[model samples]
Target: MSEAIRIRVTSQHLAESSNPAQQKYAFAYHISIENCGREAVQLLNRYWLITDADGKKTEVRGAGVVGKQPVIAPDECYEYSSGAILDTPVGTMQGYYEMQSADGNTFQAPIPVFSLVVPNLIN
Candidate 1:
C-alpha cells in the first residue's frame, strides 16, 4: 500500500460566529481525502488532537467524520467540512483515520497537522 490515502486541509476564521471579547473563536475546516492505492477504502474511525493558542489540548475520537463513513474508490476522493471553537485565535489539529480496504484489511491513514488562525493574527 503506497501512500494508501492522502489528506489535505484548509481552514478559515468565522468572525460572524465568533465573539473575540467573550474569548470565543470559531473556525471551519475543510478536509479532502484522496485514495491513492489500487483498492477502495472505507473510513472507519477518526482521532483528533486539537491545541489552542494557550496550549490547551483537546482530543476527539469518534466513528467517521461529520457523521458518515464514506467508501472511496480508487482514484476517487471524498470531502467534508466541519467546525471547531477555541478559546483563542489560533490552534492546530492533527489526526488519523482507521480505514478498511476492499479486501478487509485495516490500516491507518494519517492526517498531517494544520493550522487554524484568525486573519492578521500572525505576520
Candidate 2:
C-alpha cells in the first residue's frame, strides 16, 4: 500500500553576525510533517539532496530528522526544526522523506524546493 506524506518548511533567522567582515549565514528551518494517508506511517529514514547555485551537491543520510523518527497517524501532523550552513547568500533546497506503512511497505514523498536568498545577495 502506498501512503502519502506532506511536509512544509519555514526558514527563520536565528542569529546574525555583527561584524561586517564576517561573510556567513545560518538558516534554521521549521518542518511540519503530516500524514494524510489512511493508516499510520513511520518515518524510517531520511535522504537530503541539497544543491547549491554553484552546482555543489551534498547528500545527507540519517535515521531520523531532529533525532526523532515520528510515527504520524492519519490526519496527524508533527513539526521539527533544523539548520543548515551556507557560505553564499542565495540557494534552494529540496529533498524526500522515506516512510513505511505498518505493513512494511515503503514509499517516498517529494518535498518542494524552497529558496534561501539573503536580501543583499540577489535583486
- Name the best candidate (by lDDT): 1
Assess every candidate by TM-score: 0.96, 0.85
Question: Tens-digit lDDT track for model 2 on 6-97?
Answer: 78898754357312246456677788988888899988788876666677777888887888888889999989988776555656778888
lDDT of 1 by residue, 60-117 (tens): 9999999999999999999999999999999999989999999998888989999999
Off by over 4 Å in 1: none
> How many residue pairs clash in all the candidates, one count each?
0, 0
> Global lDDT for candidate 1?
0.93
Worst 10 residues of 1 by lDDT: 1-10
Whole-model Cα lDDT of every candidate shown, in order = 0.93, 0.75
The most accurate candidate by TM-score is 1
Question: Over 4 Å off in model 2, which ranges?
Answer: 1-3, 14-23
